[model samples]
Target: MLLVMTGIAAFPWPAATAQQKGGFRKLAPGVLTVIPPDKSSADELLHGDLLEVTEGLSGPPENLAWEPQRSPANTTLVERARNRSFARDIWCLEFAFKPPRMIEVDVPAADLKMQRKRVWYLVYRVKNTGGRRTVVDKDDPTKFKTETFETPVRFIPHFVLESLEPLSDAEELAKYRAYLDRVVPTAMEAIQRREDPRQRFYNSAEMVAKEIAFGEERWGVAVWTDVDPRIDFFSIYASGLTNSIRWRKRQGAVINPNDIPGSDMEVAMESLRLDFWLPAAGGNAAEQEMSVGYRGMFERMTLGSRVLEATGWPKTTKSNPAAALERMGLKWGDLLEPVGGGGPSMQPLEKVLTTIAGLKDPAIRTALVREMFGDVGEAALESLAAAAAGPVDTEQDKRRRAALQTMGLTPEQVAKDPYKSLARIVGAMDSQPGYAQRQAMAFKCFGPAGRRLEWLSKGAKAARALAAMESIAIDPNSVATGNAQTAFEAVRPSISALADEAERRKVLQGVFGPRGPDLFAAAVAVHEGIDHDWVFRYESDGPGL
Candidate 1:
């Protein structure tokens, strides 16, 4: 049992020769070693570490070798994996940067030279382990069964290094120390700025891999959450320069694919240092944040949700999600038991169903329904055939009559396949420019023409309501002022008649950004002929519905 403990106490070891594994030239007097998962004596990497230290690149005019000192802290074991396929228990190494020390790099402009120092170390390797677990089947009571499973324990660490130059001067050192006292927030903000764009909840790194240039150096860190359900914690650094230094994690997969040729993964990060000169007393110092955590973080990643803001999806009560279903006009009793015992208690309506039903324009809906659902939505339209025979009085009715007339179908032909007949009826109604005109006409209608559309067939009702919705422009203000009132009146009836309240509410949820359910209720009130007072009341209070 390799119990990988962590500590910062330094120790010395006997001199060793640099071992070579293809392009990974292992450093002598090594800090750590990696045994390949294959467990082959030929495949074992001798006394060395996993940093691809590149030197003598053309940019710096003169670049000296990064002479690595064995980090003062002993290598802490961050994870242990038993790969039965390789028949080996692999221990992943982690350690922190020793004290920051100076390195010399000559710059070209004006022969200017600056003393620079960096503290770089591998943090931890986030990994998912899979194996077969043998358990007695509770169902059979005495039967033993083996099940294969995978556990996702995502170990995410952010490496931060702050360096200020000219340590030879006591005043410069004092300024650097004082600056460290104030650099926490600034350093945090810098890290946040880089990570925010990449810090999304993705199961696999592949999702964001396209967002980043593969194998090219980037300035930010890439982040991913465990695809599986697990509680992951991150260390919160305290105010001091070394207030809380935890065990280091492996940077990431290697940067140069050629380095570890044919290896499935590479080091995730290449650089883990940030350098900033202290401000000249009152004047601010130029701070440069350097990072490598973004690279190789996406390898072997499973795709998952990319949640940027919790505000977008507010958590509702889970005790009775069925209540929400009831509110959506679906009876709780009607819902089939979820196939899995421990999933959501209520079966949510298919998004497509609500999308088809809540659409703001009948013409668009007709087109989409025909294209997307095809024969699938035919059953839902079965009941509408009877409505086609109902009296045609209002302009909405005349429009339906025009649609049926265009189909040129006899009553005998309509009765044989009611759903198909209804689909054809709507499809025919959609063929004319008058379909769109009537929708807009209903939107502008202040009298019975708009109100009477409620009695039309479900398809016509949905279309007319959608057309009204299209008429009103989105308004950010809660009060029904200016064009907001027109927009509200247009969508009011469509939303009210929608069987799915959540879908109804979503129509206004982000109509102009995060207005929430109140806007939906206000629209409903306008449709109900209550007008300004109720709409204002809904806006002032929360969504009363």
Candidate 2:
């Protein structure tokens, strides 16, 4: 049995006594390599050289080996690191198995109900390690910083098997041989046909949508730079891996985290590359440092299949807020205060009614009305009906009006509401004579002269004159203003097919003098509430027409 230790303080390593410990080796000032204590049971199949602690380091030392040592109480190992400017300290507390032994079972055939693979497990405990308080920038809300102490734990490996244990019993050996014979060739063929795990890793839903959760089912790699630990803005990923070699390669072109994905196994894996990160507006000082140098630390834990299954670490199940609310028969409006507080509320009623209109599910809307308002449902319904009865003058109405006008429509035919406007436009287009009449009606409603008056009201005399002329050409009856003759004379030549360019210019100049175009532009700009300088500014070509 593996020895259990407890209640240890930070930084327990002394340089002189380090070598005497079973298999603790110092790789760097604050980094140490730990090995399992039961050396006899550990074996070569474990790939000792590829142990996570030694290989996962940023720059590991060459030509160093160590034996596994039973940890003293609480802390498994503590290492102290220092450079010219700062110091780092790591404290490791291990939670080893109760038995600290492997299960002995004959290898199962591939066709067996229980198919097993030799997969290693690792765990990481990432925390804020932020300062006592946070500092916000006065000028910029997005920029902020924090103070942090205590060096982050760099590398902790749960596995450093000392040696391999082989099947020695005759019956066990026979079973192992038979299992291999039955499975190896099939396994090789399957491997050849299977899609590349790397492709799946990159294309995984979790990878594309970098969402991480901090819950019981978290597996794989979780990295969060800006995390507020106090509010639980931290993410976790749990994964089973033989080593970190592949993960290290995949870490670049890093997909930044937005929110936590609710599901695990979104990405398929030969060895899981589960990844997600929690986000906060601001980041911890230590995390910032680690992120800058790609130097974050993670925890590693080895677990037997049975132990993992018992702990419920197999897959992540994401929670659905909408479904949850539905199951509770609750609406968002129910949680919000009324439009006007203290007495009866209108806001929730308004929101709930509006939302209900679009929902297809009868129960969704019914439950919203019955459950959300209950006693006040009648009052809410009355208010909603009143609001719906009023004139259609919303932003949507304005957009529909503008759209119909753009498509050569008049108010008479294109009534209020998108459905009516769409129907009118479609009806007008279905018959050529109806389309021509609609066009004529549009011209008559705001023919060139009337359009000119509108522009002048907005301060665009030249544009008004030009538009007024075009309208008259489309429909002679469009000129209905008191200055009808003057307006007609202004654009008469431009309307005539026999008029030349010079004749049109003379008519335009007579209606609006040489400076008319410039003044009209300024007037239009002012009417629209746009910057006058932007309207008048000249580009490389010239002032825009």
Global lDDT of each model?
Answer: 0.27, 0.25
Model 1 agreement with the true structure over 116-169: per-residue lDDT tens digits:
222111212122222233455889956755554322112233332222111321
Candidate 1: Cα lDDT at 376: 29
Model 2: runs farther than 4 Å from truth?
1-223, 226-235, 240-372, 392-396, 399-545
* Per-residue lDDT of model 2, residues 1-545, tens digit only: 00100111123432221111122121244321122211111110111111122223213343222333685332322111111111122121211111011111233455775454321112222221211112456788776434333222222222211111112211100110100001222232233233122221111123224322211111112211112222211111122211111111122222212212211102121111121122232543222211100001000000011112111111111112233334544443242321212221122223333444555676665554443333244243433232222334466345445645756654545332322333333333223243244334333333322122111111112122223333335322233322422333333333345346554433333233333232223222322211001011112322112
TM-score of each: 0.17, 0.17
What is the alpha-carbon lDDT of model 2 when measured against the actual structure? 0.25
- Poorest lDDT segment (10 consecutive residues) of candidate 1: 299-308
User: lDDT of model 2 at residue 325?
Assistant: 33
Query: Which stretches of candidate 1 lie above 4 Å from their native place?
Result: 1-94, 97-324, 327-545
